[model samples]
Target: MKSSRIGRIPIPLNNVHVNAGDPFQVTGPLGVLTLTVPSVIKIKLYQTMIKVTPVFSNQRASAIQGTVRTLISNMVAGVTVGFRKVLVLNGVGFRVSIRNNILTLSLGYSHPIIYCVNRNIKLHLISPSELEVFGVDKQLVGQTSADIKRFHPIEPYKGKGIRFINETVNLKERTKKK
Candidate 1:
């Protein structure tokens, strides 16, 4: 069988150095990240590019190789330029602030919610209700954003809560009083 189409597209090393092994290590200006390779996939390093392949030609191997290739690609991009996620709190009396890697959030609750920020992730408060999550690891940045958003997801009635920069939420009308 032909090699996985996505896996054939070599991943550009850019400013990152990749070490292929049981757990691939990607080092760059941002920092270092490691990804444990699957048992059915193989990785080859080159001067300016990295190639991935499947150990077998079966259906599962091909799918795994493609996934591995995309993940490594994201890793390279993550190390080179980094990743960011923007979140907005859209409700009255909702506010957030960061101090010493700790987030004190007031989301209309009786008491503020104190959140401990991740060491690897940088939390930047653009405003009282808007914030940005920055990190070299794409997964970490996204995970942190999701965790914060979970505190108060958007309500269908008011469409108020934490939302990503590009997220779209539909508001529902209130019930009529007879």
Candidate 2:
């Protein structure tokens, strides 16, 4: 059986504790995260290092092994260093602000769009057009940023919309008439 490349690598713990059980739990300085380990994959702890191995030598088991390893790795990283996502709005009359757990956005629309912030995620406005999303879970941070950007996605014409920090938009040229 060919072992999964990523599953063969051990995950190192840095000031983090893992409870190996039916419902696995990882605790760090930031917070604690719990996950259900798949029956096909087994999690073993060797001192500060964690290893994920497939219970069966089947292809499906190998796939699950790699996936479980990555999920656990992400959880450990999230609880330790956390995750962050930045969004920037481009164009005139674009603004974003957070107040009283509510995010207010004005994307050149008739009215402002309001989004309620999640308890686990923190939203900050660097500028009127720049927004920052912070959370312990990578999925949560990315989803929040995507939800906000969905309100005014980048247009191919004017490039006026919400985008990531390094995201670039390709603007289309205007049509010429005789």
Candidate 3:
């Protein structure tokens, strides 16, 4: 049986406090994250490291061992340095504003779209067309970014809409006017 190579990699724990229980918990300066550890994998938390091992030699156990290790690693990182996603709006009258934790977006729509910020996530408007989402949970940060972007996803024709900072949109060429 092939063992998980990723599972063999030792996860280095910084100043995060980990509790080995039914639901593994990790707490750091940023925030606290909890993950349900599988029974097939055994987690050993040391003073400065974390080890994940399979209780039984099997394909499922091996796969789960690596998955659990990665989840735990993400939890630790999330509660420590946290995660962030940046979004950019591209359009003629595209604009964004934040007031009282409410994000107001003007994407050529007759009515401005308002998005309430999640308590766990922090929202920052860098400019009229740029925004940043911050959170300790990587999933929440990503999901929040996606939800906001969905309001005005980039169109292939004009590439006018909300998109990630690093994302590249291929604008469709316009036909020559006869």
Best by TM-score: 2
Error of 1 at 132 (Å): 0.3
Q: Among these predicted structures, which one has the highest lDDT?
A: 3
Q: Give the TM-score of candidate 2.
A: 0.96
Cα-based lDDT at residue 73, candidate 1: 92
Between candidates 2 and 3, the one scoring higher on lDDT is 3
TM-score of each: 0.94, 0.96, 0.94
Query: Residue by residue across 1-178, what tens digits does model 1's lDDT show?
Result: 7777888899888878877866899999998889999999988888989999899988899988999999899889988899999999999999999999999989999999998988999999898889999998888898999999999999999888889989999888899999
Which residue segments of model 1 deviate by more than 4 Å?
A: none
What lDDT tens digits, residue by residue, belong to model 3 across residues 88-110? 99999999999888999999999
- lDDT of each prediction vs. the true structure? 0.90, 0.90, 0.91
lDDT tens digits, residue span 83-169, model 2: 999999999989988898799999888999999989999888888989999988888889988999899999899888999998878
Candidate 1 achieves a global lDDT of: 0.90
Clashing pairs in 1: none
Ranked candidates (lDDT, high to low) = 3, 2, 1
Clash count list over all predictions: 0, 0, 0
Model 3 lowest lDDT segment of ten: 37-46
Candidate 3 displacement at residue 18 in angstroms: 0.9
